[model samples]
Target chain A: MATHLILRKILDTGFVSEPPPAADPALRTREQDLQEEILKVFGQALTVRHVDAGSCNGCELEIHALQGAHYNIEGIGVKFAASPRHADVLLVTGPVSRNLEVALKRTYEATPEPKWVVAVGECGCNGGLFGESYASCGRVANVIPVDVEVPGCPPTPVALLQGILAAVSR
Target chain B: MRIGDNEWPLEQRPGCTPVWRGRVPAERLPALAHDVRGCGGQLTALWGSDDRHLGGGFAIHVAFGIPQGTAWVSSDLGAEAPAYPDLSAVFPQADRMQRAAFDLLGIVASGAVDARRWLRHGAWPEDAWPLRRDFDAATRFEPTLDAYPFIQVEGDGVHEIPVGPIHAGTIEPGHFRFSVIGDRILKLEERLGYTHKGIEKRFEGMTAEEGARLAGRVSGDSHVAFAWACCMALESAAGSPPPARAQWLRALFLERERVANHLGDLGYLGNDVAFGIGFMQFWRLKEEWLRLNARLFGHRYLFDRVVPGGVACDLPAGAQAALTDQCDVVAMHVRQLKEIYDEHAGIQDRFVATGIVKPELAARLGLTGLAGRASGQAVDARVDAPCPPYDQVKVAIVTHDHGDVAARAEVRFGEVFESLRLIQELVRRMPAGPLLAELPTAAAGAEGLGRVEGWRGEVLVALRMGADGRLERVHAHDPSWQNWPVMEPGVLGNIVPDFPLINKSFNLSYSGQDL
Candidate 1:
């Protein structure tokens, strides 16, 4: 995990200096550097389609936040495509709701081959607080194939950007 | 059968009684429906509430609205079994609404077609309505699927495309069944209720104040609307008016909530049309605004800040000023984004003339809120049935002549300015006094209706007191119920790719409808 840096550095520091590269080519940025580096291995431009099985909109807010100027995932060639057919990455959120399970499966089915599924919240990963909801089938992974899991009550925008970048790099 | 103003049979009505009182007979339902339809009223919400406290009987409440006033009709069924007349024959959209009523309350809509379970799965026994009074809160059940009969769309080259209750993004659950030929959608059917939180069933025995708190959580984004409606019902039942300051505070919060969701949705709609840059810019500004919500209101989504009687916490003087400054910043940024969106021809091409819903169709379908307004069905509760602070201040409603994806987008953008203006006016004219007053002891058998304008549209809540002076049952209806079914017609003639932009333009709340 990246070290906690409060707003003081962002608000107070006049300018930022890049951190030095790690001793190894892999395991360099923070947790799982090798995983992060692998995202860059697949050079083809990536398009992501986002699906919400039944999110509280907490993670949706942050996932949407990644497009903001501060994070700017688009600058790194990560784009949100409207339909799964054009997507290389299928970004899923929320616990899998019984009502939405079939729709989620179809969304994946619509996407072309060589697609990767990324579960994008604690609920998506493991159903979180609403885990026991009768309407919720289970976690997103239980209903679909998830290659990368982004965990947090709501992962911060920076964390989401890092996760997406990691996927593209891999 | 005609009563004062509303035509309801006096005899055979659910008299105000202890335990479970005030339930109308099931036989009177068809008359009530005919009366409302004759008056050109719309079925606002239809859901069942548990009356386990009154024994095993569960009550189903049907609320309808005219231009200004709202009428409520409720019936009680056995604790083990409940039934209601089907309105889908009159109101085509009531099919799913009735299924939802069946899912939680276990009420069977007699002679109702398309009886697929709305929220309940094979996980729970059919005899067990999760929203029933005796259902254990901690009980866990696995999902079980029954036969879901999909209506076949037949023709040359016609095929079915079934989508999820589980999706790729962080959104509520719903299934999209499309019968398409080529890229053209011949018919589109949506199956929702995956996020049914059992909100109505959970309200059993809770004090009015406690129930209002849970109401706010129904859909996190529309906190003010749900909270205000619940509080209004409680206040009306208790005959306690919120303090002047609380009313003003509620107005401010409501406007902020409206602006924030509209902003986020507008950005996503634009993004769906392939306007990536527009999405990035608008969403960035929206995030900054929400961060300010966290600062000024405590929670990022402004959850729990709105409680019954009044707000849970008062705003510090500094926080008020900070909110004003942020509004100014957002206004400036929004104007810039608007310019880009308006001038971008490619984006405009994709949005304009797609998902066209004629004005007459909108009225017949009972469309409410922005979707209704875009199609010229102007029925904002804040304007018609003014309450509290809104009654004191004039609410400017924005309407559009064309009811298409573009019109919806334009309506939302226009509301952005109106909401910001409302925020400024509210802050400058905030009244002095306490936020809340002591709630009155609600009389047994008293009934009250609460209507608030949520960002999506008008949110209506109705409550009836039992003979024991507790909430017999309550109905919280989101505008989505009226709008979700309309998406089918809206997507017709438009290509499949255009559906996303059109869908985002509507941005209906699934949880709101599911509950």
Candidate 2:
């Protein structure tokens, strides 16, 4: 009787995900007329390798929220890769700590060509609070090239999705 | 239990929690530690601070959990070569803390085992100590990497698998080296501190009030508890007490944070085993709960919500009904989902007996908070030494003796229900008053300590005031410090693939502990 409850619970609570919101035009920093062709290249698929350089795990929590039923990124053909070698996009968080500086660079180099790097959170965009200090490099762009920067103490799940989409459209 | 032999009197600070402190000679700590442990005391936190500028030398501080409350004992060492007796023999958890103190302040624990650099991973020069009175916080050191020597295991079929500073999951950075034979792990060692962002060094720039924000970010997931601990310490130091109304709301926010983290962890534990229904239902419940946080307060994670004196914001209108209804809704869904998790054999197969930390090992290693509770080491700050509103509310202590992944999950489930009941009580009993209080002007040469049972474990913030009304030192200790070392013993007999499931069960914080 109890074993059947697992199957019954799934049937009772049907799919809870909604269609993700459309990408904001203001966040689309590029000219629309110039980038219509690039959208077709990787529009339906993107594999991300997330690097936590030194975040407090705020941005990480928001990114984890994307996998939930509310904003299911997997349903829309996006998945987080277990290895950087299998990834098409590198999603990095936190102001890069000095200890993980070389590790971040090596992980960036490990990714194959034609990969875009998106920096997530206020720390990633501008080194939020723990700015350049003895133990912190401060900001993702300071260490490696960043294609997109999502700025919030930690950007919301919707904002992260928009940032990732903006990177692909570029 | 009292700390010292009365050469120096212990001064009890004015705070909700009972914290007694005293300073002693460096030679007196070992005997004091032995006395505390003899009365069933546990090590709370250990750190070192530079005192050369004050005409004294360097000072090493240790806090221990005693029968009455927490006993904070400090000893002064001379400026030339500051070294204190090692307590790792008495408290195994003191090893890394001692190493971290040496790395930051250049104070040596006379005879510590495994004294490799803990937090200073070659990012700063060997001679450069960030916590010293003279070290400049603004100077940018050229980034350098260093090699860490992992102890090797030799046998007929022994091989090594080095895991990460980065992992497959969306977690913080920490490396794990596992030596295995035929998929059964013989031994595991973890090299952490990749998330050290000069947080303690950064605190020197802020006043006690501004230090609130930095404390909250020490471990993002435990923001409410950490900020509250800092505020409590600052309030006690400045001779100001938060209003009773503010205390109630702070407790509510704390329970909400606990609920949020437990929800996320339970959801991911199911995800680790590919249980689709459990992950969806639990996360859906969590999304609604976090949405309520953003709607009620201004932030989803409750960052900066708990301020220096009391709180940054008040409970909004309709909060009582909204929160009570959320408690009802979440309780219903969690009850339904937990039933599924309990009955599903696949989930149980991965959970039960996967990774075990026996009770005897837990006490000796100083495992604390929820993980400690699951392992039968019954220690919860809310129950043991209740602070402010927690003392007002009846917090039922929860525990299990199995010391496995299944027991940890069961504890989370039990705590969620208990927390929901508390949230209901809190909303209905909500009082009307001021949301935030003005902190007194910061004073120089004053010190204070704040301890809270954060979601992950015991969160302690030790603050000292500096010259010009700025913070001299802030050591935010996470329970992960005590718990992370035990994972080495936790995964001893477990297979490699089961590591993720076991780790998620404990769900300790990397950023929190690394700081």
- Model 2 segments beyond 4 Å from truth? A25-37, B1-8
DockQ of each: 0.23, 0.81
Per-residue lDDT over A1-170 for candidate 1, one digit per residue giving the tens place of the 0 to 100 score = 00122122234323222222112223112233455444465464678888876666667777767666656566666788877898888888777766566668888899986677777777777776556455665577788877667776566565565566555443
Span of 10 residues, lowest total lDDT, candidate 1 chain B:
B12-21
- What TM-score does candidate 2 get on C-alpha atoms? 0.97
In model 2, the clashing pairs are none
Q: Per-residue lDDT tens digits of candidate 2, residues B1-515?
A: 34443333577877778899888888878888887777788998999998888899999999888767788888989998899999999999999999999999889999888789989888898878988968888788776658888999999999999999888778889999999998999999999999999898888859776798888888888989999999888887777888888899899999999999999989999988988667777888899999999999989998888888888788778988999999998898899888878878888999988899999999888888998999998899888889877777889988999899999999999999999999999888877788767877667877788888888888888888877768878888888989899999999989999998888888888888787
Report the TM-score measured on chain A for model 2.
0.90
TM-score of chain B of each: 0.89, 0.98
Question: What are the per-residue Cα lDDT tens digits for candidate 1 across B373-432?
Answer: 999987787887677688777888899979998899899888998888888878878888
Q: Candidate 1 docking: what grade?
A: incorrect
